[model samples]
Structure formats: C-alpha cells, structure tokens
Target: MTKIKICGITRLSDALESCRAGADALGFNFSSLSPRAITPERAKEIIEKLPPFVASTGIFVDQSPEEINAICRFCKLQIAQLHSEQYSPEDARAITEAKVIKVFRPEENFAVEEVFAFAEKSGINAFLFDAYRPDMAGGTGETIRASLATRIFNALGDSCYPILAGGLNESNIGEAIRSLQPYGVDTASGVECEPGIKDPVKIKAFIQAVRKTVF
Candidate 1:
C-alpha cells in the first residue's frame, strides 16, 4: 500500500484533521522561509495530542545538523526531511538518530547521481521528489516527471523508498501513484484551502484516492 503524508501542517486543528483522515505521517514545516512554518513549541503541542502509530516529521532547509537535531529532539519528531543544497553531501550523510528523508527537486539542478550517491553513503530512509519551481522552494504544486522519479527509485536499491510530492491532489494522486509506484505520496498545497490550513473534504478524498492505488 502507498502511504500518505500531509505536509506543511501549521495548526493543531489541521494536524488533528490530517491524522483523523488516516495520514501515516504529518509534516510540520520548520523552515523559516515557508508560510506554513511553525515553531517547535507549536509542533510539539500538536504532536503530543496525536494517537499512537502516527509519525510526526519535521521539514527543514539549509540548517546545520545541530539545528535540525535540536528541533527534532524538542518536538519528538520521528523523521527529518532535509531539503537544502547548502549542505555538502558529507554533512548530510553524517546525520544520525531519527530517520532522515532527503528532498530532491530534479529539475532544480539536483543531480540524480548526487542523490543516489548520497543515499548510498548516508543510508537515508527515503528520498522525496518534488517539482522545481524557480520562485518557490517547495510544494509548489508542480509535478515531477514519472520517468525521472522512477529512475531515482530504481537507483535506491530497496534500502529507501522514493516519496513523490509536488502537485498532488485527490484527483491526480492515484494516477501519480500508479505511474511511479512510490512508497509514499506527500502533499502540502494540494489539500489545503490555503497555506497552513487544510480542507477536510480534500484531505479525506486524498487519502481515499491513495488507498485506491495499487502502488
């Protein structure tokens, strides 16, 4: 089965809703650049209320390992999603403790070889592929090519799952899953009424769509 992750959660209500909608993971954006950004304190509050079996992931960009670890520890996050080109492959590969998911936008000068090599060296848990939008840093609602994402998946060698993101909604998520057969699908703007807020109807429909996919 393909897992569903609802990203860019900002409020307790939205977080709770995503969890109730059967999201396996809830992503809290800690990147200061994002409109959906939330403080560790806020994320913790929401996470604390979650039922067991649901994972909380912290979304970070361009932070040193120290900063990333600090927030993850504070929020008790189960996973860390890194999406920065600033870190040398060495630095990124060295991170330990919580499961790490490195984000790659193939169209944004992100070399597939570089990502494959990093995963080989770092032993990350997964790779998130999102479309590259020049003005926006993430979740721009633009889709990555199925072919390129599949190539990255094949290169991972089963050690890590490739998570498809960007431009996913209830309508298209099933198609994306069928084509890429990713381990999971991530969405931020796709199920939102606006940044930081989720639309309940959309959230339910999105998860339903995911469950309908064969992976």
Candidate 2:
C-alpha cells in the first residue's frame, strides 16, 4: 500500500490530528525561510506528545549537517528530508545512521540518469521529486506530470524509492497514485488552511482520498 505523509506540520493539535488520521509519517519544517518552520524545542514538544510507531521527520534546506543532526537528536526525529541543492555525498555519509530522503528539483531538461547516479552515490533512502519553483523550495502547490515522475522511477529501478510530491490534494491524489504508484505521497499547502496551520477536515478528506486509491 502507498504510505501517507502530511508535511509542514506546525501545531501540536495538527500533528496529533495527522496521527489520528492514520498518517505513516509527519514532517516538521525546520527550514528558516519557510513560513511553516518550527524550532527544535517546539518540534520536541510536539514529538514528545506523539505515541509510538509514528515517524517524525525534520525538513532541512541548505543547512549544515551538524545543525541538522543536532536538531534531529533534540527533537527525536527518525528521518531527515534534505531539500537543498548543496547536499553532498560527504554530508550523506556523515549522517549514515539517519534515514535521508533527498529532494530533487525537476528541470526543464531534467536528466534522470544524473539524478539516479547522485542518489546511488549519496546513499539516500528515498528520492522526492518536486516541481522547480524559484521563490520556494517546496509547498508551491504546483502539480507536475505524474507520468514524468513514473518514467524516472522506472529508470531508477527498485533500489531508489520514489516519492511523488508537489501540489497533491484530495481531488487529484487518486489520479496521481494510480499513475505513479509511488512509495509515498507528500503534501503541505494542499491540506492546509493557511501556511503553517492544517485544516482537520481537509486532512481527513485527503487521507480518505489516498486510502481509496491504495486500498
């Protein structure tokens, strides 16, 4: 079954709602530029409130490995989602104990071979494909072609788990899942009433839509 991840969580209530809604993972944005950004202290407060088995992820962009590691440890995050162009194999090697999901910005002339090679060398657990938006790293609410992502995933084979993200919502999630059949689907603005705050009704609807497609 395709897993569900509700990204850009900022409130304790929203986090708990996501867990109650049957989310496999919850993403906390630690990137400074994002409106949804949360401090390690705040993230820890929310993480501590969570029950066992729900994975917490810290989202980083152009942040030093030391900073990422420190926050992850403090917040008890199980995974790090690196959404930066500056991430290197050395950085990945240093965070060997952590599960890293590296984000790739799709280009007009995107080369799947080059991306697959980098994923292999970086030793990341998964690859997230997002539409390239200059103003924001992600949470752009712009949909990309699922077939394009599927082709890349097909080329990369089973070793690289593909996550289809960018502009996924309750209405189109089923179509996206049916076409790509990604390991998981990630959403932020699509399920949110505002930048950082999530709407529970929308959240429930989104999860329901995903479940309908997968089950």
Candidate 3:
C-alpha cells in the first residue's frame, strides 16, 4: 500500500488531525528559509503530543550533519529528510542511527544511473524525487512528470525505495499513485490552506484519495 506523509506540520492540532486522517508520518520543516519552518523546541512540543506509532520526520536543507543530528534527537524525529544538494555519503553515514530519506532535485537532464549510484553509495533508507527549480529545494507546488519518476524508480532495482513528492493533492493523488506506485507519497502545500496551516477537510480528502488507490 502507498503510505501517506503530511508535511510542513506546525501545529499540534494539525499534526494530530493528520494522524487521525490516516497519515503514516508527519513532516516538520526545520529549514530556515521555508515559511513552514519550525524551531526544534516547537517541533518537539508537537511531536510529543502525537500518538505513539506515528512517525515524525525532520526536513532539512544544506544543514550540517551535526545540526541535523542535534535537532533530530531533540525533536524525537524518526526520519530525517535531506533536501540539500550538498549531501554526501559521509553525511548519510554520520546519521546512521537515524533513518534517512535523501531528496533529489529532478533536473531536465537528470540521469537515473547517477541517482541510483548515489543511493547505493549512501545507503539511504529511501529517495524522494522533487521537481527541480533553481530557487527552491522543494515545496514548489509543481509536479514532475510521473513517467519520468516511474522510469527512474524502475531503474533503481532493489537498492532503494522511491517516494513521490511535489504538488500532490486529493484530486490527482490517485492518478499519481496509479502511475508511479511509489513506496510512499509526501505532501505539504497540496493539503494546506497556507504554508504550515493544514485544512482538515483537505487532509481527510487527500488521505481518502490515497487509500482508494491502495485497494
């Protein structure tokens, strides 16, 4: 079944609502530039309020491994989503104790082999492919071609799991799942009234849409 991850969670109520809506995971943005960004202390408060068994993910961009480690530990994050271009195998290794999902910016000329090679070398838990835009690491609200994403996933062989992200919503989530059949799907702005603010109705509909695809 395709798992649902609601990203950019800022409030305790929103996080709990996401879990109630069937989200397997909740993503907390720690990237300073993003409007969804939350302090480690605030993330901890929200995470602590969540029911057990729901995973909390910390999203970072170009942050030092030490900083990532510190925040993850303090916020009790189960997964660290690295959306930085400067990530290296050493960085991944440094976070060995924490599950890592490395994000790849989909360039027009991106080669599948290169991404597969990196995933193999880093030994990451998964790969999240986000639409490439010069100024943004993610949360661009732009969807990449599913055919291209599927092709890359098929090429990865048994080395990595692929998670689709970027501009997914209740309307097209089923189509996205049918085409890509990703290990999981990540969303933020798609179900939000605004960045960091989730709309309960949209959250429920989004989860319902993804659940339909799974069966």
Residue-level lDDT for 97 in candidate 2: 35
Alpha carbon lDDT of residue 107, candidate 2?
70
Question: Which model, 2 or 3, shows the larger lDDT?
Answer: 3
Candidate closest to the true structure, highest lDDT: 3
Give each model's whole-structure lDDT: 0.83, 0.86, 0.87
Q: Write the per-residue lDDT of candidate 2 for residues 1-215, one digit (tens) a residue.
A: 88888999999999999999989999999988999999889999999999788899889997889888888888889989889888886787667435898888787667887776777787665888887888899999997766667677677767677888999999999988887778999999989999999999999999999988853
Residue-level lDDT of model 1, residues 102-210, one tens digit each, is 8878863445677668766776668888888766768687887767666766766566788889899998888887877788889999999999889999999999999
Candidates in order, TM-scores: namely 0.92, 0.95, 0.96
Tell me the lDDT of candidate 1. 0.83
Flag clash pairs in model 2: none
The parts of candidate 3 lying over 4 Å away from their true place are: none
Q: For candidate 2, what is the TM-score? A: 0.95
Error of 3 at 88 (Å): 0.9
Poorest 10 consecutive residues by lDDT, candidate 1: 88-97
Q: Looking at candidate 3, what is the lDDT of residue 45?
A: 94
lDDT of 1 at 31: 83
Model 3 alpha-carbon miss at residue 93, Å: 0.8
